[model samples]
Target: MPLLTINLNPAVDTVCRVKSFNTHHVNRAYEVVKTAGGKGNNVARIARSAGEEVYSLCFLGGASGAWIAKQLTESGIYPVSVEVGEDTRTCIAVVDERDNSVTELLEPGPVISQEQQNRLLDKLLDLLRSKTFDCITLSGSLPKGLTNEWLDQLFAELCSHDIPFIVDTSDSRVLDLLHHKPTVIKPNVQELESWMGTAIREENDMIQAGYDLCRKGAKAAVVSRGEKGLLAIRKECIYKVSVPKVNPVSTVGAGDALVAGLALGFINQLPWPEILRKSAGFGTAATLSYTTGRIDSGSLPSLVNQVTIKKIQPV
Candidate 1:
């Protein structure tokens, strides 16, 4: 079955590569690539690369939005776009090859009016009624004019249908959605701490916080800890996933790739171990590759094998 992805705020990401980026000075870039991006859009791309059928629903407006639609279509993703009044935003990622570090400048995105929000929601409902999906993913940030309360209502509607939903978003938004009880939430360590309003100083602290979120409403919480790996807390068990050492090209969209992996595993009903393996492997593959949200297919099998998944027995 195809996975349904919702990206309320989509963008065109420009990735520029520079050997040594000097601040306050003119720098030359050897390579530049641009693609359709947003957290949900990235998930769609990565999931498709992993051989999953995906359908993307997003809001598009003005010239940039039109361009993003074209990019999505070119990427072999079926785009179901809703028209809006404002221009879609653009984001820039400067990859410093010297250090393999990525500096990002993100736009706030278009302000979604109430009517536009309703239209998008209605479109989503129609899609849900017309098609059968393995799962649904809601990602990226909420554009202006839409509050967390609005997101709660939308998620409640999705929950009413009993479809599993995965969410990856900003820290502030994560707290509000916990009440709605999404099937899964992927937040980084710092983001998780912010959502919980506390500092997570160690591995155990992170695990407990993830579990706390699970008890509140989320069925599971996946806390991303960059190169250190992943810590996942579910009702049944907790997972610790780590990848083999490798020099990262750009970390830009690796988290999104991880989300895609989780979606794939959830849709396939894979065991938690297999799920974390895929999640870590896909993330590592993306890091090994130059493109954002894309994994080297050849590297996945071996990379996945390199992923170490340790189950922490619940007391």
Candidate 2:
């Protein structure tokens, strides 16, 4: 079964490496770079690179949107998209050489028309009806003008078919998805804190929150802690997964790859231990590269072998 990716909010990625970046100063700097990106698009790219068949569903418009479709197709991603009225959103990433700080300029996604949004949803369901998929991944933010009804209806379809879902989102919408019991949910440390409404100072507290999330309709929960490794709760147990330390060249898109790895593992029926290990390895490998949302396959296998996932009972 192929992996199906739904990207309601797509982006055009522009990255530049600036030396001694200064604000309010006309900075003469590195060459500007652009790439096809968005959370779901990146996940599909990583999943396909891992030797999985992927179908990408998104919204694109205008010349930039046309270029995005061109890039996705050229890169071998199957684009199932609908045309909208406005241009697609763009994000600018600046890498500071002095301290390796990356400043991000993210534009809110273009407002999707009601008709186009409905048609895209219809297209997604039609594709799902025509092809059976190993898993379904919903990544990134919901665009403006898309209502909760839209997401809820989509979740209903997933539930009716018993297709497992893995979602990466942060908002009140998450509270609604809980009723649908998504197969998996990945939240970073800060997002977890926001949901928990308390400071998570220690390992035990993190584990407690992971369990709470599972109890709240997530079949399995994974919380990513930068530089601290990942905490996973599944099979009525929690585990801490770590990898050989790498001085990360970039932190962008690491979480998306991590979720992709987890989704891929679930599709392959990999054991829980290996799934967690692969999740950590994919993330580490992604950061090993300097570019945003790019993970080289050559670095994954070796990194996978070095990751260790320890089964633990929270103290």
Model number with the top TM-score: 1
Please count the clashing residue pairs in each candidate, in the order shown.
0, 0
Candidate 2 ranges with C-alpha deviation above 4 Å: none
RMSD of 2: 1.6
Q: How many pairs of residues in model 1 come into backbone collision?
A: 0
Please estimate how well model 1 matches the true structure, expressed as its whole-model Cα lDDT. Answer: 0.85
The TM-score measured for candidate 1 stands at: 0.96
Residue 257 of candidate 1: its Cα lDDT?
87
Question: Can you write out model 1's per-residue Cα lDDT over 163-258, one digit (the tens) per residue?
Answer: 778988874866656777888888898787777788888898888888888877898898889899998899888888888888888888899888
Candidate 1 regions off by >4 Å? none
C-alpha lDDT of residue 242 in model 2: 80
Model 2 shows how many backbone clashes?
0
